[model samples]
Target: MTLPVDLETDAARLRAIMAEDLAVRGVLDDPAWRAAVEAVPRHRFAPGFYLPGEERDGLGLTVWQPVTAALDPGRWLAAAYSDTTLITQFDGDEPDWEHPAERHGGAPTSSSTLPSLVVRMWADADVREGHTVLEIGTGTGYSTALACERLGSAGVTSVDVDPYRLERAASSLHGCGYAPTLAVADGVYGYWPEAPFDRIVAACSFRAVPPALVAQTRPGGKILLTLSGWLYGYARVLLTVSGDGTAEGCLLGGTVSFMSARTHAAPAFGNPAHWAAELPGEARDARHGPERITAATEEAFHLRFLVQSAVPGAQLATVGDVVHLVDVVSGSAATLTPDCEGGWRVREGGPVRLWESVERVVDVYEAAGRPGSESFTLSVHHGGQHLRHPRVPCLPLPSPEGRPGRSRTASGRTGHSSSQLARE
Candidate 1:
């Protein structure tokens, strides 16, 4: 099939778009980042591609279009340069370029995180010239390329759990005339063959910072990552490795979802249809009761997050007026009854009550004045302990002057202010 645009022209156009977009957004002003953006050709990274408007049943459709490799250079370039996610692995496996049908079923396992998020994380890492860096989740090798542009190819080492992805990314990087030490290994272990890294960035999110990553960095080196938590949103954090290997840094911005490192990937919950059939009609109805809050633009995303978090292994479907939350962990199914009025009810499971959990999250959101991702704060302890709040100090509160006052931090830490955290 003939594509509408020439590859070189598309590549040039992509560079122009990215430069302009980042310039307008204030991300391209950093000369290092700007250089990296200019040097990487997104089309070379995504060999098989599809245009953005193409539709397929699931997430698989986006990754398997080799023809797109020639036709839609802009889509590939946009995906490459923009701060939006490009799905790389679906359900823990690399997409089979030979068979698109296999792409369905599992959730997204890896991606090149949005360009903006990567830039923010790089800024948080505070990487300097000649810094040795280790990047987790090499995906399409786009971010690795950026790191190479900043730190030099010799100073970077990139790793991923899937050997196929690593191999493919190695080729992509090589085609671009840049090469870093690429390895097929579990990212959770941190690549120690080249240890004492000055900076470490995880392209994937994790419930906790792997102790190995902290231990592998030089004292005072920065480790930037997305801290995963039960809350719907995640926090981009910057932690400094101490001589003792313990790390501490404050949250940098809002949240993003990334495939958990292989060791942390959530176990499969099994077939959804079977679980739906097993749910009791009453429990399902109660969970789907009318939503009490007004319908707002942000409600859908938050609602999806809460439902997925509350009902692990469940699939959520919104069909026009009704929302369906289905869980099929054991070939047994339960569903939440949809309330056209915006309420929820669970029609399955014993007294565990999935709907109640969702309602609780909704109540929290309402109490917080329906703040979107920006209004939340997340903090994590060294051992993976975490807390979330709609406001900050995250604990005991005091006035701006540091005097003990009636208002406490939402999470209650004294002498802390919520103003320190920013949203991405």
Candidate 2:
């Protein structure tokens, strides 16, 4: 009863709208980036996605329903061209084939990342005409397509841990007339076969730059990755590898949280018995005012980084006025509560005196003028990587204070649990 819609005209209109939005915000300034954005047909990559409904469910939960070309082609194409992230995969839950109309609920495991963020990272990587770019975490292959359009398909190499994703991406890339190299491998190790890459950009986040990534990069090559911690705080960095095998760079201002690399994810959290096993190790009292670091504000960004650098693998969860800190590596846990007086009380356990370190680091950071990301620089060595600032003292990457023998996956490779990792 209905004629086929003119997809090209519709896609072009939406692309222009996206470009205008980016230009007005001063994000699409690079001619190459602009050309790539305009040329690539984003709708080809995301055949189906979940869009969160404006209304809440009876239980006050956000409703996310799938939209596909068969269900609603026009709306689907519009969303594909929008600037928002499109959810492509849900973790932990599988679709119910019996109830085809049912909507599944779970954490978003993969997605088409926001276009602006992707371009920003590409810009930071300094991807140029003749540069060979190795893109880690090739979700949906949208970024790979962009790189292929900007440079040549021969200059782009993309790798992802999931073979299923790589297969889908390959089809999408081929559909768009791009045949960039696609590999099914762990991004943590980077692709050694494609070594000496001029530009390396990771769409995923990790606590530290993998030494292998640095070794595979050509001298003076640039690397960009979202530097994230278990605290869930993150910042972007673009480091230039030197002949000495050290890459130093400053953190880009503004927060960015990507799915943690699969190999870097932590094990099961929220197991009551897990915490119960370590509660009898130690007990501690108030060390200092937790508000000096726990208060949520723009200024607290540096303070969060301070705690992450000091404690290594600390994760934070706040309930009411109390902040809970747990380290899977060290089995250390601490509960910080605001004291009636303007100070704070700390109850600690396990081998690590996390509260004492927090107090000491806060003092040092404050004395150093509470430097921001601009003052922070990364120094990646073969042994480890440490974040340093001119004003704040150098903090070496601490041993991942997690439980030994619990970090590796069944494949006998170093891998984290599903809880601590995401791919999209």
Candidate 1 lDDT for residue 7:
54
Candidate 2 residue pairs in clash (backbone atoms < 3 Å): 110-424, 111-424, 329-401, 329-402, 330-401, 330-402
> Alpha-carbon error at 112 in model 1, in Å?
4.4
Model 1, 308-410: lDDT tens per residue? 3333333444445444444333222345454666555556553234445556555555666765544443333443323345442122111112121222333
lDDT of each: 0.59, 0.75
Give the C-alpha miss distance for residue 308 in model 2, angstroms.
1.0
- What would the per-residue lDDT of candidate 2 be over residues 133-153, giving only the tens digit for each residue? 899999889989999999999
lDDT for 223 (candidate 1): 88
Model 2 lDDT-worst window of ten: 415-424
Count of backbone collisions within predicted model 1:
41
TM-score of each: 0.69, 0.85
